[model samples]
Target: MPAYQLYVYEDQEKREALEQKICEQVDACTEVNGKIRNRVKKFLIEEGITDISEMNAALRVRYEGYLERNETVHVPITCLRGFDRIFLHRMKEELKTLAGQRKYTTEYRDQWLCLTHYPDVEVAESFLTSKDGKELVWNFTLECPRKLKMQIFTVLKEVIHTYEGWTRKEKLLALQRLYQFCVVNQVSDIETMTLEEEQKFALKLSEDLGEKKKNAVFGILRMSRKILFLQAPEINWNANVWFLERFHFSKERINPSKPVELVSFKEVTNLENQKILQKYLRYLFGITDLCISTIRIKLLELRTFLVYFNGEEKPIYEVEAEKIQRYLESIQRQDTREKTANGRIFMILQFYNFLVVKRYLKKIPFRYEYYLQKEVHVHNDRSVPEGVYTEILSKLAEFPEHLRLMFLHLWCTGIRGSEVCTLTGDGYEEKDGDYWLKVYQVKMKTYKRIPIPEALYKLVQVYKKKYQIGPEEYLFQNQTGGAFRYGTFRYQMLKYCEKYQIANGEYIFKSHDYRHNLATLYYDSGISLQAVRDYLGHEYEEMTRQYVDYMPKKLEKASEAYFQEETHSFAAELMKGEFHG
Candidate 1:
């Protein structure tokens, strides 16, 4: 590998000296065995080094004997996987030639009759077995290259290693179809392949499979596309080579990015304010690195402040700290939570900072700490009264069993709605005679195995049997098995809100209220607050404290744990017991 790098090394005269020594071998040697140059090339061939740039620092010491006293050293570009940037161009060229595009089009349609049919041609087969054929095989792979001829075959190996789902048989068939698809169709780089070409190939595979063979060939083709998407950027071509006009892969695997809207501030009606607002938002998006969702949320908050100051800034750069304070006071009139008010305050302060940095404002605005609302204790209350919890459960029972299990899974495990949507039918597990609910907590990016009560376990079992759902399908899919996104707690509450409402839908408790109910009740039943914190996946005990309520000291006086038995009443069930639900 080191010797091959020396071929392209910038010091042309010195690299030529090393190349000549390797080519001439013993004849170019000053020493008896000519071991240095001979051994370098021999080591590369023996080690099966295809990408010579993998020549590491330690290996460079082997060439130390040949180094001139003050020569500058170069950095190695190869990654640990032996992926060399230098090999990219040559690999594409070699693959294009091996796929025999010019020969295939010229000969398969016109020239070498003996070899045009490929592998079956006897005289061609004889030539392939000769010395030139031997070189062809060696150049392609360390493996038996005749069978796996294209560069894409090596790429397929990488895909199989990373694909965690498939079995050995499925992968082997995928490989067979991939190699045949590449060579016969003359595809060198699959990432640049068009949608029409992919569809045509998929149709051909379906015809060949017939009724006798199972048609899983499409999976292999998609696998090839995924592999191309992942590896194409590693080469020096167009960085967006993998992007296509079509999206053929799984939406779950790759969530399609929301389309970016083109905003025109001209609709603001005030010309000066529109121009300033446009430039400010454009500057915010361009300068700061934030995800689109976070930026959009911040931008909306900024818009509220802008609307409040609508005609105040005639030239769009005027400021008054008293007016900004009045805006904050108006927001508090809506009974906004302290956290939400703080978020708006945060955005306003940042917008002022941007204006100051741009020199548009000489000096302006109130400091964030001065206008802040006094702490709203009501937002900290996360628990419902025991009677309300019982009512919610009874109302849920009136819904279908699957819908009921959705609430049961969230309430029992204390996982969020986003995590619940991803739960599979096989998420239930038993170990050491105890059932565990597998919870994938998306926010914390961790998994939790919350112990399940028999009531909840039985409820899930009934749901599976009644619905005839497979263990692998999504937990919350529709009756026909289409997935509904877990957008918000509104997905759970809206339908029942009117029935539960004391007035308008404003007073309805959210699905997350069940999380708070469990956290508080668990602690009330003599469970430690630290345990509740861990179960809730809170970053700090302080956040968990916000979720749990203050339990009366007298509630801790019980000799036996109230949660030991699953009940049918207020605080009826906790995480323990074996009663059939």
Candidate 2:
């Protein structure tokens, strides 16, 4: 490492002394005119870039006026574009500022940042002066050919090692291997490649390699740009949803099933739209604690809108209401569900609101505010009938202990499908004589404790005692004593349904429907609306009532007066003709 001195400036005398050192190096070279050389020299002097030294590896220069005293590094040459071709880069302001002067090209970048794929030295020399715009220059060196990969591997490895994940080192090595495969297959410029071509290449690679190896390839290829974004200050991080999965499987850490769709800022195409989206996304990620699953949804919304209008390649903020209406109509044709199509319109309204608030648009250009409410009426089919629950529970008694405990817990607690698997022993706590089940709702990102009634509370106590569960152990673990898995839960439910000849039509009763059953039972037991909301972790009163909204008008009033004292007999209230005909 080169030693650095701050050159703490006190007065003009010290500054002049530092300026003379740079002048001496310029004075040594006699190829240029004094006036022309001084003109270039004046820009450097005004910019405070005079500090220069000839290191063993390369000549070093640090400008003044910069806080760090080490920014604005320039070429070793007396002039900007002179031969000896000392890679001049790191423009102070915008690329347009330099482009207007004709002093800099559009491709201006630091020599260290550029990784050329071309093997010819002549072509490489042409790229230093930027004469040959033909040479493919990857921002990440690992994407370059063998020699360049060897040069960058160590630096990139050190950077990758700084990330929090255990797979950081493996990701780096895998990226290198993938890059080499790309290079060998003549994929010199991925950014310029058409989407179809890229997909074909991926397909070819998958066919050549086995499925396992192809998946490994996708993992590395998908992560390649994200790793570069973390390391490179020049290249920015764009949160583009690859496929934007229809659902988030919490087991997969909410990541999409596939991440290699070649979706990026390149999809936006319009430079202004790219800038607005970049700013918006950066602001959102910085301010919001939204889960990765939610973030992907937002990213996909932006991507879909952008791609919809990409044919014209106009800036997205320039959109009019007619275009929005047309887009909505188009989406209606594509999506079969009215609710799904209307949800797209709802998101677009919010997106328009974002643009106006962020000052990306002059005013709200969309006239679809009145159409925002899409009458998305959902049927009250997400619950098992009282007769159905009685049959299921009686049949469940014959199953294994783990299977019985899982269903009974969800039934009594009204917990979501995945939440049942994630419950910890510490989640169960005694307050006075009452035991509370601590629930951490992943979607709402909040925690609440629901009081355990006598029968279920006793069951939890007996279950914990029988398993010899510690405070940190899972409240409901598997037979192997590990956390319960959703896949295993579904499998067990399917087998139970098959053996008992139970089915809710073609669909077996889902774990979520048990939550519906709990909500109905609570309302029937005259539990307060506020209490139901608190137990379910719902933020709004309206959401809490959604469970009971489907009941008959008479039943709604009747249920409030009805309370089963035994708690376990709450289902019997539902079995009466008021709930089941």
Candidate 3:
């Protein structure tokens, strides 16, 4: 009823002699006759008679019905060698063809038989074989062990064959099938098989010759299957094998000729030794896409290097520098935009030095020294009057209740519009008689607690009551009852400003501009630069100083007088001129 099973048996010398006789007859046949020759051969071999001429006499004396039924025919080893060699040789050829076609490579040898490529041995006395194989070898006085089942050695072999020359994804699937077979079959002691056994197994499965002549064949098959199944497509199986062979299998010689190359941003792109140039454009000037129109020339130069040096062994740093200089010279000859070119070159030089310090490159190229320049900080020229805030607040009153509160929150706390949109009930906290919202600034990588003004707090209460605020709800939920994204919030703010005609129609401001406005206001209110910096959570005082220049002249004068102990009238005079209260 089952698809297949295994059988073990114990056979003494008599049974062994009979099986050997049958094997000899099979081996001697050059071409098989009809059933008569088969019957005669079986009888002579099983009865242990040496000659077919003596078969009748020996069978009649020993047992009856020897010729009556085919199963009754049994031969002995002594009689097998004496059988016609032509008939025996044919039988052997037939058996070998059958085994090969069925993917069975095992062969019988004398009384003791060795399975092809399989580690297990079947002796004359205690022979363990699969059920089907046993059926073919029955009538030899051998018995099957009830519990033993057929072991499909062919499954592993076939898997190994299938994985060869397969693509990464295909190899992975093949390995999965192999593992499933092992788990399902409960195969154990795979390592016990000798090199002969493994080779035999491989020969049985497929005709292709594997690289490893002996024992390593099995290991290589297993490893390759696993790699194909478990690792990503980008991961190189051959490279991994080479690494393992070099390190783990020290004695084994594996030399891979064409190794994969690792490319960098610049190497892939082909910019000259302009490390500083690239860095400045990318980081300082905020030009993110070097391959775009902004830096097309540099990108083209990098592309040329990649093509010219294709498959060549060259240090990436050197290649990058050479390509960058070529581009620079080309731009100079053409009388292109000198300012932009110089800026790029300078940044590249700085970036080169940085890479050297990080040990990514060995040496800073000589051209870097010529391009190095000290960085300068420029002041913004935008200025706003004190009345501008009041005017914006009045325009915000014309919008919906929630919009009004959102504007007030942004203006009062100096938080970004996106942060305001993302605010939820959980962000609000009360501590030491002060209420504040915890702002998660992604770029800053820290949470900021911005104090809520009284006016804004009252407005929030009104907004919450109107919306029937829930505990886990966003404070500024959109139509989907979820927090608004940055783009949506910005759009809404711009729309409101347009509709209200606020700040002389110059009410356009980014979410970040609020922080700048707050910093300026804080400095004008006579707060110490350090105090303002702490409140804003700025790492450097220089960043906070950007707002200092924007402070009202009156406040600036007051600060100067306070520090220098000059005339107090200086503050009054400066305020009269600068303040439009």
Candidate 4:
């Protein structure tokens, strides 16, 4: 390391002369500027820093140290600022004359230095300026072998190019920790890292980092092994998960509440089983009309079933009806819900059907209906309680403007939460005096237009105008300018409801509940069942009936209307007997 020059003067006469010069510089400034300078001068004289050195950089550093150690240091920040303005700036020319024209010295940072040791010079140069590289601490990778360093850099390059925000930062941190572990263990090849070494690294991380941080690091590493090392034959970390975005699902226009991101087959450790599952997924995603979300659920259910039979020596093709019965019994022993259990069995049956079509299996293993539990479709009261919604409306001003408007959409229209999230600016239309809002129902896979409150329509127009939203843009959007996530909306609404103590802090906000509320309200207002069904975007009136709650009032109203009529046979006889018999 090159030593920085210290210009501390030992002679008193030279120190006094330099102090006088600094004082003279202060005197030339106005009173406001001179106040802080005067403090710096007084501080220097008190410290007996009558040392003048050609290296002003070194001199300033020494002065800073004195300021820190001194107990009675007054306005140190101001004094430091004054030191730079007067000593460094005003006296720069004089100092340069004393030590020739070398005003600033170069100090090589470890980050820049590590580049020389990197295997690929051009890659290092490009990476040095990349987003991930700019923030990396080079000390962790300094002693790692060329191949290991190259692997780390490659992963980082992919991470920088692929991800963004805190996700990118987190993956970078995960890689850095991995690099440090590699360097310490003298492991040169990350691709050939052993399972034992992987376990050791995880244990070390858990000890050094807390449980949460360690888990996060391991999660990122697992994801990187799947994503960044796609062509690599093997990696130490066992991650049989794959991100769905790589398959171009975006083109399909399927954006679900919980994004269909990764599918994990880690439970099914058999490589042949994994390949079979992958082929099934590819078939579902490509050939079938099934929604991506539906496909994801099927994949999860299949993974569980495969995990159950993982210990078996036989391949999935050779599984007989007897084994299938055992698997069914094992699942039945668990405390799974009837509906969920039935769904799981149904998915397995579907998978078997797919296998038969592809010639992987000679025939289906067992009768699907025999294993399935009878599922009763009992509808729960999902409507938001009157007290809860009324309370929300009472203090609606307290919530954000956007949220308040979104609530109105749910309150006024019996639309789904997903439809509310994906409302576009041009979805609103005015015909003569009536206002109508058009929304695409993701579930029904169609657009539905219904009359909306004039006030609500105008409010939306005003909001769009205020936000400068274009016709093609979503009425409500996330930070990324895409349609706002329904999950995020629900989460934020619940947070605020709890904060403001809505329903005495006991009520959890559910967006779907508002849909039910609107449906019930429409039914109670004497709207035809067919009209309510249409408004709710339901395929059948029977399905819409499930959404209608508070049915007792509607039933009571119907009974009262029936007896009031005198012309009806039973009602007329009762009226005649009471009045003239």
Candidate 5:
């Protein structure tokens, strides 16, 4: 009496008797599912549909009857549950067989009508090709009235076909949630949702999802509204307000792996504050020469500054030195680092200056120097140790090809992690009998060209060919076909490092350290500070100096050189015997 064999039982009476015995045995068990008992009792009492094939026949007859009545066919939950236990696998096989026979059975309305089995083939196929047809046809179903569902389906058909790439999925997911919200609120049409209704839906999303997902969904909704509005002009949405509340930064400029809140600002509460922040952001974008990355940082810093005054009775325009002081103290209380705290203070001062210039404030409220800290720029010795890197290289062949190549970029060229992740297929060029690599420096907002080892160039060429990367496409792409995220690279590197037990199982790989190593290596080999500055894309000679980690051996050599010189120097003469020995 195998469970699956019960589906093909011909003798109804014997099958019912055996099903009763099985139910009794299940009920006697301590761990029996209550739903199973309930379903079995309901099936036996109400319908007495024990045979699986007969159950399918009954459902088919019901479906035909609904079609005759010009209605959507409905399947009961109990039957679906029973199918889950017995005929779920068989149903899938049957679907495949029906497809082979040129009869498609795609699910349209969940537990209701099949797209192919509908009364009208043309209309059903039209729905199949609409929206994210392939996925939506199989994955989702509308549970509203026929008219409303059709209206939504029409809009979604456009949405799925209109938006491109990853955005299509995002629009679909957000729209599904929106559809549910519409049904719950009894909103007849999605296109005619008022601003108030949209706001209420946003609030509902906030309550339902976590902060990160809420912001992401908010961004998707905001972006998808353009097409939505074009298709349905009656919709009333405050694009300006929504844009400032939560929106995505340019994907080309911002790393996807960065914290969502840092890239997308949603903290400013007051409408006035949001407008001011929006104005500032626009000013930064249009007027300033600052790069998008730098502007994002400044915008995030300013958002924190503005959010502190969210509940204040007075607006942010009424700036006072005491309030600024309190903000500084509050930031300090969080154990903020000196350099970071100084950067934040600088941002605040810059914003206040901008306010004065824009006539938002008659005068500057506070002295910038009064609140600023004198940050001591300490050069951190972040160069990867020789032993650690050597061990990594020893096991590098066993690692994934992408990681190996990325590590080589870090190890040889000393490029930033972000730069490595974003390297384009066209970044490599041949000039003057040497191979050069070009990388877009996000921090500097410029392109930097530097010579690379010939071996690495050949390897990259092979990789590009293998992956079929186009000229403008990223050399290393993520699962979503965007630039390989820096965070993901770092995460994978650490995992592999731990797996391979690099540096005796304790080395925490920092991508920036490779930059330090190459800088130091070049300086020690007699490359000038100016040349290093240009090579590292540092705007200042002093910044390049910080990156060059002068190891103890290099210091010893410098000391020896100074002491061994014939010219009389105070330090050389003072330690003459020690140096001579």
Candidate 6:
């Protein structure tokens, strides 16, 4: 058999009365029919009672009546004392409305009693204890102790007297006057007052305190206290003082007789030794305030000078070269592992050559030969073979809409992922009757444009509509609707591939693969190498040839057809015999 159910909407005070009525109705073995049933049903109907879903008498009688003969029904009751009756009534009405709207029947049962949804508990308590529920409780109960009755009478009298004594505007003026009087009397510390004193003070202040004056007084007091703390002698010992000290400068003596000269590094041996020395000093001192690229460039220059000093025709002695090597080795060993020791050494060697060949430094060192030989081993690892382009493209097709668009943009255009990430609406332009996305290559500091595809254009239109893409908003915002981070995008791509079971092949599908794919596809389609280079926005044709060589079948065919030995020999013979001089 299905479970018994009951449904009722009653305010807190009425809840107990209703429950008692239900119990009496059940105990009396009342036969609900004809005139009696009609009277009860009419009362229920007038009270807007509909289906007995939560508590159904008929269902309860059929299923749990036998249990009722041996047991008692228990329903927990919580008295919402001092709560607003009108609010509770409205809450009941809302629940009923919801029940009616959903067409709930006798099959389900649920109950709730909500007081208020105010965020602050204190405010909710204050509103609950206000005059709103007083009359509703009074109507149902008259028996009370004389003291309670007298308390109620006094409260009502005070409220009525206050209301009748002054208009709202006059009360506001009185509040301002009272607040001013309190301020003059130095009684602003409300905490010092007893509860009764506070009540009296509040009543008096309510009549005279102006909202603006109260706010101004509070603001002035708060600011004055803050300023006093700020001006204290101990403020110099605060954390902020140390932070500001970072920017402070000690007085330096100026050489008034000799003016400082501005000269290019190129003019001074085509190298800035002082800048290199500063970078080395910063690195040694663990200072990271300098730009990474600037530090790298300076390090490279220092290495070049060291290499030149060591690798001159008149080589530096073994002792001197060992000293230089030890200094560099010490830096390498200091709290950091070198990922590419060979690369570091190669840079050092290159810098040495620049110093020597540029006539900035002199001598080849015999001890440096061992380091050079050791560096060659680091370069022996074979480069990974390019992964299948088709596999990457297929996987990219299944990417989420936004990422798919990004991949498509990358694939069609040979632009780097970083460049694509920084692409904005401002980069798009109508160039020679074609819509193109302009990208500035950060590494190269060069600008180029890629034509937009029809599909991509449509996708962007929908994206703009959904995101309400403003003129200044990033095209690809993250989940929280902010610009996508490069690290986040890369992490997402890896996770996506892993979930989809894409093979981790020789070449991982990095952002640069898109450039490779674009170049390979265009080259294989019989486009001229020079034209392909121009399309991919490569500054040099030699770089484009790298992609051309990757497509060995196409390269072999072009070599056989255009540069055959027979063709070359015939052309040479014809040139030798052709002139009718």
Candidate No. with top lDDT: 4
Q: Write the per-residue lDDT of candidate 1 for residues 312-344, one digit (tens) a residue.
A: 646546646666678877766776777777777
Model 1 Cα shift for residue 43 (angstroms): 88
Task: Quantify all predictions' global Cα lDDT against the true fold.
Answer: 0.53, 0.56, 0.48, 0.70, 0.67, 0.44
Q: What is the C-alpha RMSD of each candidate to the true structure, in Å?
A: 22.3, 17.8, 21.8, 12.8, 14.1, 26.4
Q: For model 5, how does the per-residue alpha-carbon lDDT over 1-581 read when each residue is reduced to its tens digit?
A: 88667756756667678677555533443332476445544453345454333334335344334334533324343333332333232333345564533433322344433332333344333333333232232223445555456555555666645665467666667766766777778876544445567788889888999777887776644544444444443423322332211333455455433323223334666657666787787787667766566787898899888888877766688756688788876765666668788788888888888888988898877666766676777778888999999999999999999999999999989989988998999999887889999988777667889999999999999999999999999899999887898888999999999999997779998999999999999998999889988999998987897898894467778877885767757665667765577
In terms of lDDT, which candidate is stronger, 1 or 5? 5
Query: On residues 1-581, what C-alpha lDDT tens digit does candidate 4 reach at each position?
Result: 23332334435557778789756755554433666666667766665564332324345556667777877776555555555445434444443464434432222222322321223333333333333232433442276577676666667667756766567667877887887788889987764455566778889889999888788888755655555446445432333566565566642347554467766665675667777887898788778866677788889889888877788777788877798888877666678878888878788888899889989888897887777777665667888887888999998999998899998998898677777888889999999999999888655556788999999999999999999999989899999888888888899899889989999999998888877888888888888879888888888877787788866557778877876775755757676796567
Worst 10 residues of 5 by lDDT: 236-245
Q: Residues 1-581, candidate 2: write the lDDT tens digits.
A: 22333334344667787678666655444555565445445545665765422210111122112212424434233232321222222221222364524533323223323221122233333434433321222344234444334333433444343542335434544555555556656554432333444565567657877777667656654454444434444433343322223222243233111122223555665556766766665655556566555665676787788777776666787666688678866776774566666777777777778888877776776566545445555546477777777777878878888778778877788888677777777787777888788876667766777877677777777888888888888776667776677777788787877777765434475887877677767876888878877778888977666665445554656665565355526676576645556
Candidate 1 global TM-score: 0.42
Worst 10 residues of 2 by lDDT: 55-64
RMSD of 1: 22.3
Q: Which digits, one per residue and each the tens of the lDDT, describe model 3 over residues 54-161?
A: 322123323334332435345432122222233233333443565433432332212221111122112211212222221112111113211111122233333333
Runs of candidate 6 with Cα error greater than 4 angstroms are 1-319, 322-398, 430-433, 478-483, 503-507, 549-553, 561-581
| Per-candidate clash tally | 1, 1, 46, 2, 1, 24
Better of 4 and 6 by TM-score: 4
TM-score of each: 0.42, 0.55, 0.39, 0.66, 0.62, 0.38
Candidate order by lDDT, highest to lowest? 4, 5, 2, 1, 3, 6
Stretches off by above 4 angstroms in model 4 are 1-113, 116-151, 159-173, 179-201, 222-239, 250-253, 330-339, 552-581
Give the best candidate by TM-score: 4
Compute the lDDT of residue 288 as modeled in candidate 1.
Answer: 54
